[model samples]
Target: MTVLSYADSALSLLPPVVAILLAIFTRRVLLSLGLGILIGALLLNQWSVLDTGVYLGQRVLSLVWDDGAFNAWNLYILGFLVLLGMITALITVSGSARAFANWARQHIRNRRDAKLLTMFLGCAVFIDDYFNSLVVGSIARPLTDRYYISRSKLAYLLDSTAAPVCVISPVSSWGAYIIALIGGILTAHGFTETGHLSAFVQMIPMNFYALFALALLLCVAYMELDIGAMRKHELNARKGNLYDETKGLPPGANADLPEAETGQVHGLFLPIGVLVVATFYFMVSSGADALAAESLPFTIIGAFEKTDVGSSLFFGASIGLVVTLLLAFIQKIEAKMILKALTSGARSMLPAIYILMFAWTIAGIIGSLETGKFMASLASGNIPFALLPAVLFILAGLTAFSTGTSWGTFGIMLPIAADMAMGSHSSMMLPMLAAVLSGAVFGDHCSPISDTTILSSTGAGCHHIDHVLTQLPYAVLVAVISLGGYIVLGFTESVWLGLASSCVLFLLGLVWLKWQQPKNTNA
Candidate 1:
């Protein structure tokens, strides 16, 4: 099926809007995405039933295979998710999670301590958002639960930290991908004064939303400033109801699994340690291999740029899974019990896998509709130079929120944003680019179909929509604060002044929330 002429028009916006609104109101994520895909297909096919069906089937098939080859990246990622599920289950069955919780109980005396520790763990695991989202929640849940922190709150912590932290850290997979993109953009723009790495470093302070998001997370943790729906969830958690039982179990929560009585903290630590180390090793090795094949210099950043993230993650999870199984055997867990845990863990991941599949499908459909290009086109007209950063921020946020993929938005908007800035506001290039990064992360944080958001909910064992709803207000507040910062930077052309403005607004937000809401008893 071919895209209709109307594909580039306002009609293209209908599908995602329908999906997002439905998801928010009905809380049926898969259904919403499916309907959106169908609408997108119908639009592309001019409402022909047969063509729509054919196009939809072809799009779904393209997810796993296209161009006479298997989509190894997608398959590898799906495999990694299953393997990680098994690893999580194996560790829980080994009683390591419990042992670690028991050990933590001695050191963490209050709810604030548990929350702060969780945030710290999230920040520490900044290599990849996917790994960060899943690993942090699995490790931090038991401790947070001990302090009566809601699964929703746990999810908020994971979702907020994962992407925000990764986008800012220069050593992360996200950083590598972004740097590679920026390198090309810089070359295309004939920018000669700075290298890719240097440009990225320069933009760090200008990425107001990401920095403020992390800062907001810190305040929420230490000061107990749970705003809006989050406050409700925290209250429910304090009352010993971590989540609404009537809403059904989340993706990673297998309620029927039994735990071993004799397990140690080493059981939990070893598998996670191997997983992290192996992933890092494979990433570097894979990147190096790719670089050597291309006869490129073997720099760390170059290697990361060439790394196969999906394959590396899959291999790392496999190694970690093997170690987990061996640990179980050494602990003398029966073969039948081990087998049960394996099946249960894999089974627990099915819901998340299903959601991810639908998300990927609809994202592809949206791409075909050229929704992002259409959105980017809006900013092409003559506009004042001083407002460029703020405009790019809003446009980037809209594109990502519609498409549910920050990387896709980056690909579409970065070039346009860079070109716009370089053409007139050359000095504002870094600020505009930073605005795009900040806005994309904010949109990714808010989108119901975003993979990071889904993984965060899965990791924390909270209902996905609950995580979406609870995190929305917090994300919006930061976006608002960042928008103001971009505006200030656009006018003043001073990164520090812009950053100072955001910091002030953020602190003022915290103080206002503190004064307006009653403090939690635990706080």
Candidate 2:
């Protein structure tokens, strides 16, 4: 079969299924991505005989490299990780994290406040979800543990909010790429009128996935609707069957907690502050381009037309790291110890980074195979057009869940869905698109093997499996509500109706969960 035809056979379902299967069997999402990508590339290459793998690799690499924006995001993520690693090192070696923990331990009397603080700090680092995860996870790991909040749950919050929040915020790294993608797509399809600003602005409200994901995260965090696998896994997913993995309360877990240095919390705030100032400055200055808003006068930045969030963040984090290292040097902190903490943190990120490279390669394969078009073709135009919005949302949701990327889901869905919307339900186009985006995010927000989920797990010091297990139910809860809202929006043509339906669904789910629990159980 032709690549596109086979793509018609399997694209959305295959990628995610492959990812899930790999992660479950091998405990490695990257390897699965590699395999999936290889299959995609091979399909794209028409399964050429005699040295097909070699031919496929060359073609796929060439195609991916042909587009600069596509390639930059991967490197951008990698470079961004450096700052996160350094900041982690800086915080640890400088004893700032230790001091903060001590301060919080003594001052904070309320557990709810502490949980909210974790979520608040997570919101504070809105520039990049990846950045948010690494920084927040490392910082809040201890704080969450102290309050008896499970690491799995903490990771869930961090991961859930990271990508969804970044995508929603214009200043975040994610927003930049999606904007660029949208601009290109709109311009290519003659959809852009007068420089694409209006089109982009219109897309924001339609981004249902981002909005609902944020709502879902808030629901999980403060509302504490820890039902389903959340309550079950939180109770069980501990290491070695002897420890609580979600809460990190297993024996010997805290044995590694630093003596006095772990108790230090000075200079930790500096890195965080720099991140905020730099992010705000860049976001405001760039106006709309992800990189255009930064105000970097030094380090070869003055020569550039635009300053990327990745570059700005990396720079700010570097300064924070240097300041931290200096603090460590000025004090009697052991250099070996400092280096070890950094090395450990860096080591911890390897799996995530590896998975990303593979994810990119796999996503590339799917793109090369024209998977989006194939999936687009699969839509049954004969079906009631009213169902399109809801179906699109569901498709987008599944795509995001499968690929673990909302943007990928959007990229594949938006054009065709938009075309369908424009042709059949002209007025509902904007809301329809929003539903697609919303569905994409809903899937990504909850998926166990998604990069964001992985980072959240890493951030919260929650075992990867634990986070996935705990977070899945919340994602489903929100999704079910969102689906009902999409149905209302499609049929009623009223945005308010869809929104109201989703709210009702959410409240109903929460109430049902509460009612289903055993009476007089421990809070």
Candidate 3:
């Protein structure tokens, strides 16, 4: 196998660093990412203006055509997204979603229930983060709006539950990706005896950030706790203002869909139920086939290990779209109206699809520059064994923050972290692995340019920057708690102790925030 090489100089960091800074300063994600790709191409081509321009164009074209639009994994994601959009459109056009919201109005009764329902839906759709964000947002938005919950709060709830839940769920797209990365690394390092699925299971307990985020989300929902910018948004929401007048609402808030005439809940439940059931069925069937192809016995975990997640998701989404259309027809929705809804729905996804493509392109550019390698190389020496996990966590977090991608961070850091652990304290392997995963998620959760973050904002009909600002404090709080846990685990090597301490710390933090709420309100 041939590995792409770079000069291993500090310049290797320029592309991502510049991209992150530009995004923060300008708040223009597409421009920032495009600039980052251009810079990487120029660096790779040694700054020849003509060659750099040519290389940049070729790279973009190749990424869109060869690696993204046509690639099997990319195609699956595109198909899934399009089909999901169609399903959402059908639901909206048929008035199923609005009807469900009407039904929920009678049952929800309070702000806490609305928020909790959003969180529950987010957690329930754990198969894919993209699916989770969009589906939960569409279903929960109307209910949240009825309760006067801030769009920022809705976005935060959707965002928090998305990647965090997927990272921990063993049957998710995230799990499949992590398994493949770990499996390849273990095989390369002659540690194949410890199966990838088993190793991933071991890391779950140590995934402090994901666990803490979920716990904190539930606490926030149940307590109706509002702090920082989120507090202001919540206060405004109570006055019938869903968003800040200055920031304005997302364009998605103005989608052109028909109103609910029937106000029946079955329109919502039956289609979503089909989507959930069909997704799992396809995942299991695809995984089973893969396992059989390898002449291996079919077990649930083993099947997931072999599953093609993107393809399964695509198939599942397709089935969901079909089922939703059938339901729409039964509801007396005309064929012409259904066609219009499908077109409108797919069209609505264009912004998110473009963002996803740019994110992928930037990641590819950074990968070619070997940026992760340069960052990981710093961990090889000078860092003490006892502090390695904590240090690695910080490094991984910074790298993911700069790149705005958790999966890309995993691709870069997992192999390096695994190798380092194999050569040192074998017992530290789980903590280190968990550190990388947690750190990546923490960064991705916070980054304004992250795809999931964008999707979350879009789903909740919140301003993208508003979502980032309102959610940052909570993400940082969890990250701090997770970092402390990793440091303790590094020293004590006790997963239970580390987890216990982290939970206590998180609870204390919440209490302190609550105590300071009066001052915050006064301010």
Candidate 4:
């Protein structure tokens, strides 16, 4: 009856690897995730039988929307998906799929463009992390598939882009988390000097860990130099070989429609343009000035005043899809045709939407676990000053991975790392804190339990665990190289070396993969 108790949360939630396995094996993400949340709440609440069911939904929703934030702004994230569905629907109704196939029929050149386009989009949406990941993944997945990119590759691109961009952006969720965490740490370190917020402002330019990760992501995308799962998949794709198909995408996701008809796919770009422009305008003009990672609640409220809450930011994008369908209507498209297009788009996202709610629910449960206290305690003590950054990185990674929420991890670890910086002899307090946040994201970006990871896999229509197993090897490699860089960083005291080391390791991996491909092909 009890999933876990307050006294047992440490044991009950440890790793969550089993939870992931069940979700994948049953092909039941929503059920598995919902049960996980229910168990989590029951663990904390210690409720009796009937009361558990009664409190389940109530607790989850309350936790997700306690300050009315989720109700007010979660729409921004989902809105793009809805819009994507709309564009796909309209493309279908306009016979654009046929047109697209026809266009591709004549234009066959390079697969490299797909990888480049994905990286370009990832960098473009640097201001908003969630919007970046979801929109980029949705937009690029189909395009990447055309070039024979694997779903794992697609998820990797999506995952890689999200946190790396967020870490660099002075305005997104990452910004806010660092400010909050660092400010707290500054207080503990007796550096009322600049406050923790100022520490983040100071920290950004010095965060070599995140800077290096972003660099690695771009290098891999640009050079087509694959390593880890990416290198393996590239070799297979090049030889017309396949990955583990049982856990991979269906043929329809990659192939052209069977029995093609004729028309144009003109509206594919409009709604996305609307979403992009609107997000920038709202982010800039809504007067949120989220650059300071200022008040999240106020920012969301301000956005609603014009952006219509988070939903409004993407409203234009969604309507843009409808407008595309309307173009079809104005050109003599039947009402049924438009509605069917819209309907198809909505249906396509049903699975993702359902799973997202469960993901949100689990996140709520983890947040309730009071991660801030746990991480803060861990950061206290006589650890070596030089090893502080690496330790913070690993701890932040663990907290984020276990909690399934990087924001929560940031809330808990950033301040702690900042405090460690204060207590230590190092003058690079800001850099140390940056390492903490970046490390949290390293694990969060790849963890099976992480909501972002789930969302990315969902966006690509890939099996989530498949994304995890394949992506882990690469994420771990980057972490290890970065860790080595951090170790030498203590003596060199140079951010450049850390960045250079990450780049070098990535290139080395690329070369190794290329050399091994002949063997892989021969075998």
Candidate 5:
């Protein structure tokens, strides 16, 4: 592990700020990230322009070889992506995806039902964001397309549900990771008896952003609430175009692949079913192995705490791929054709893989510069305890947004938030903890470089920047409401009051947007 020095200087904040601004302005994510990395290198090398170039070159090479490529986590994610891509390709080639879409279309009457089903599926696959995004998008894309839903809207639904649902679900990979983090922080701070799980449960109601995001999803889907760039995309979809023409087809367009002579819904359902079952099996078994020495009554949550999520996902995906290939052969797909489909599917995922690698590299560079610590330092000084929750919420969001990694932000903020609550406002610990988690998700949702954001676009087959642009307005609205909720909670310390107030605010905001829709349409 690389030990980062905590520097309380404004320079530490430059990389991510530069990266975000450039991405928004230029709409070139790769170039923006590269420039951010270059700036970080220059700062680290004491502003020597010549050395900065050499340092950036060497760092990029090392990252590709040593860090990004060779890291076990990265390799696991790559394997999962490749296998998932292959599975998706095989399904499409076998016409299984089309078959499933046709079957679904028979049951789904119109756009509203299609959107509802998509949301339901997204919410159902809450084990991991990666799995949720890929699976939901793959299965629902055809249905949404058949109903004239924009790819941007589909991407928004996928992206919104994945992280938000996982963060709130108790028996998920996210919950396990968060509980472990909480446990460690409590232990370190001499609060071992606090019951991390209990605290987590208590914090759920105060997870305003997750709640609001999910609520807004339903409002957007059922109410057909379209605003900003999303409205334009929706209007275009209604006109028979699924995406912005200027933005072009998403990477890994399957236009060239020939559909099978016969499409079978079972071909799609069976493989996905096997994948889901296998994932849970692997999660439980791996988790159990890690908790073998524990006392009697081994709980599911306990197993989850010890689960190696990356390995389990890779294991399940590999199994799912094998099963899919066998099914293809059983359906009399030629060996040569199967190979082609698999290769094509895996090839399609390369763009997303590239984005993930660069995102990881930039995250690492920003971490080395101690950007989190610099942000944390800003929380110093005597402030009213009633205002701390809102303050921490904003600070956590800023950190996660800049780094484009919620897990990283959690590590930086959780400990500090815990310490603050313990020292000053002991009674408000759960709310503060919830604020941190909520803020982290809020920031991650809005960040273009976030892994979930990238996967959402990939899964929905939408241009990445378009997904980012269309989703930003919704994310910002929820975040604004969440901040207000935290402030209310900070003062009243009433979870019910805070939650109710946020919900009301969200509804009012929706009404305002709906009222403005006519003006937007006219203009």
Candidate 6:
């Protein structure tokens, strides 16, 4: 599909809004995404029905085949998802999950401990959001389930920590990508006061949303905080309902698998350990190969910057699946049962795979529509210097929300932000850029179409809409507080002062929530 002449106009916002609203109200993800893509096609084709149909069909087909070639990245990611599902199912059939749950029960004394442990695991797996979401959720689900912790709550913990932690850690995939983007932006704008890595470190304090989101997760866990639809989910979970049965089994769920009584804890630990180590090694190794091809030195950061994450994840998951199969064989599980687990596991991931395809297609249409260009345009022309950071945060959030991608938003908005700052608010460049990062994460954190959000729900075996509805309030509250912090940073030109104010505000917000809860209720 070609870019429409009015691509940068307000008209570009209509499809995403229509899709998001439909998804929220009807809880039908694929239907909503399909309609959105159709609507976008209509707009691009000037409302010609046949043209719209053709364009929409082409875009959907382009997911697997584009420009006379296969789309390797998308296919690789799909392969990884399938392999991850098989591995998870095998673990359950082998009773590794139950065995680990039994082992964890000895160490985790109560529900609070379970929740806290989940948060800690989420934070620990910060190398990649996709890896973190699945691994942490798989490791923590059994323990959380043992304590009757809600799957929605577990999903919230996973979703909140993945991007927020990754966005801040310099060694993370998100960090390396953003650092490379920053390097280019800095070079283009002739800013040499700091290198890309140092600039990222400096901006960490100013990234109010990421910091506040992490803090909010800690407070929610320790304080047993339950906001919005989450409260109902928690109430249900306490009664042994981990998720809404009316909605059917969620993605990654395999309730029919029987537990093997003889399973050992190592059955779970060794596979996950292998997955992490293999994935990390592949990421670095593949990154190094890319560097070698370019005649560049092999530094960890440089390797990460050029690494093909999709293929790396695919390779890692494949190796992990082999290990999982070996463990099952060692335990003397029936071959028939092992084969069943593989088929069933792949089947379970079908919904997520479908939703992901729709999401990517719509995101592609959104790109052609120039949604981010229109969004970034909103921040130009006449903004006051003190309000620049706040405006950028809002714009970035809106852009990411509409496009369902933080990295795409970063690509669109970062250079615009650099230009805006260098053109006038020179001293506020770091804060403005930080606000974009903060907002992008904030938007991506809650958006229904976001891959991380979808994976978080899948990992926790919670309904996708349930995760989105439950997590939205918490994400919003943190964003509001972060917005206030950016406003302060903009005016004061002091990152510390802004950060301090956000911290105080976050605490106050927590206190208010505590006051609102009924004294006798557990949540």
**Model 5 clash pairs?**
none
- Give lDDT: candidate 6, residue 398: 92
For all candidates, the clash counts are 0, 21, 0, 5, 0, 0
In candidate 4, which residue pairs get closer than 3 Å at backbone N, Cα or C atoms, i.e. clash? 4-43, 181-415, 183-196, 227-231, 304-309
What's model 6's TM-score? 0.98
Tens digits of per-residue lDDT for model 4, 1-523? 4434332235445324444556656756666776677666665566565766766757656634666466555556566666766666566566655565445435635565666667778877765566666667656654665667776677777777777777766566456545555656666667787854556666665555566666666655665545565566656656654345654442113222222144554544554666677666665555454433555555532332223225544664666665676657655666776677677666666666666666776766655655434554666778777777777777777777666777777766765665565556547677676777778778787666676787677656566666776677667767776777676665566766765775677667667645654443321
What's the residue-level lDDT of 40 in candidate 4?
63
Candidate 5, which segments miss by more than 4 Å at Cα? 1-6, 49-69, 188-194, 293-297, 519-523
Selected candidate, larger TM-score, 1 vs 3? 1
Candidate 5 lDDT by residue in tens digits, 1-523: 1223436788888888998889888988889888888788777777788877776676666653764356566778778888888988998888898888888878988898899999999999998898899878888888898888999999999999999999988788899889988878777777767798887887788899998999999988987888899998999998989987676557444557878878799888788888888988899898898888665356788788788887877889888888988888888887787888988888888888888778887887788788888987788779788899899989998988888888888889988898899988677877888899999999899888788898899889888888999999999999989988888888998888888889878888898878857654421
Pitting candidate 1 against candidate 3, the one with the higher lDDT is 1
Q: Pick the candidate with the highest lDDT.
A: 6
Candidate 3 C-alpha lDDT tens digits along 155-232: 999999999999988778788778777778778877767888888898898999999999999988887678888998
* Per-model TM-score versus the true fold: 0.98, 0.81, 0.90, 0.81, 0.94, 0.98
Q: Candidate 6: worst 10 consecutive residues by lDDT? A: 1-10
- Model 4 CA deviation exceeding 4 Å by range: 1-9, 15-17, 21-28, 61-70, 97-108, 171-173, 176-209, 222-266, 288-309, 500-504, 519-523
Model 6 lDDT per residue over 1-523, tens place: 4447555589999889988999999999999999998888888888988888888788878889989999989999899989989998899889888988988889888888899889999999888999999888888888899989999999999998899999999888999999999988887887777898999898988899998999889988888888678989999999999999998999888878877787888888888889999999999999999999999998888888988889888999999999999999999999988998999999999989998898998888888889889999999879898899999999999999999999999999999989889988687888889999999999998788888898999889899999999999999999999998988888898988888889888989998878867677763
What local distance difference test score does each model get?
0.89, 0.63, 0.81, 0.62, 0.85, 0.89
Error of 2 at 304 (Å): 14
Candidate 5 or 1, higher TM-score: 1
Better of 2 and 4 by lDDT: 2
Ranking by TM-score: 6, 1, 5, 3, 2, 4
Tens-digit lDDT track of model 2 for 34-55? 6666666555556665445775
